[model samples]
Target: MHIRVYNTTNAFTSLGATFDERVLLGRGPTSSTIHGELRHRVGSLLPQQGNDASYAQLYIYDPASALEVRNCRNQQLRRDVLQTIQDTLLQVNPFVEKFR
Candidate 1:
């Protein structure tokens, strides 16, 4: 007799999605702000390389409700959002390599 075991408990979970600002707003002033803010926020989330262009809109959809935070005017709120995301990610093991 042969048997196999598959572990499905720890699976990669995607937090959300982001799209370049230009894709939505073309060429505009907000694009610049989005780029700068995205760099700051995402940079903290992951290692940043170079200064090309990371301008994007953040959309987080999970745990029932969805959240969308734009602009860097409210530094505190942006920080809070980033912290929340980081905390959540820490709590969940999104990347799992073993299936046994």
Candidate 2:
């Protein structure tokens, strides 16, 4: 699936730029167990501030993949990643704005 967030934070944008695709392999509390594989993409407008955006693409085996993300076996890491995605999305969220 796909998601687009606008007016994201700097940290979010930075994290997005460096976000690792391996996170999709979320192994839960299993410590780097990696359940599956996925990808992500966070972008920005050509203009300036207030026009930044972010996006995340996931490739789960099935809808059940939620099980890995939702009730993750690893609580801390899962919480950290989830929180980062949430907080950042709100910060420098990506969108379809035209930069000048």
Candidate 3:
């Protein structure tokens, strides 16, 4: 699988990595801000406009640290991509609190 990690600090130039399986190896410290697709099936999980966008992402909250912001195109898979993102990345499983 191919993974691309981008940092808002320098989004123009991104770091790319490849893996043989579906796993998160956790890229560099800059990867604290993560964004990208899962490779093979990524194209299938996207809106017509965002089809070219990535599915996976990594980043951090602190600009001084690794990863900063992550943006995922709405794939509209079995689950709500927004909710999936909130749950997967933000650890907001129920989303009962964040909605408030």
Q: For each candidate, what TM-score against the reference?
A: 0.22, 0.21, 0.18
How well does candidate 3 match the true structure in TM-score terms?
0.18
lDDT of every predicted structure (CA atoms): 0.30, 0.33, 0.30
Q: What is the lDDT of candidate 1?
A: 0.30
Q: Write the per-residue lDDT of candidate 1 for residues 1-100, one digit (tens) a residue.
A: 1111001111122223355555556654543223222322333322257522221212222322222221233233444444455346446543311210
What ranking emerges by lDDT with the best candidate at the front? 2, 3, 1
lDDT, candidate 3, 41-97, per-residue tens: 323322356433232212222211212123332122222333343444445334322
Selected candidate, larger lDDT, 1 vs 2: 2
Task: Point to the candidate with the largest TM-score.
Answer: 1
Q: Which segments of model 3 are wrong by more than 4 Å? A: 1-72, 79-82, 92-100
Q: Once model 2 is optimally superposed onto the true structure by TM-score, how far is the C-alpha of residue 66 displaced, in angstroms? A: 7.6
lDDT digits (tens) for residues 1-100 of candidate 2: 1122212211223232333456556565432223345433344323246531222211111223422433243343444455555445435544311110
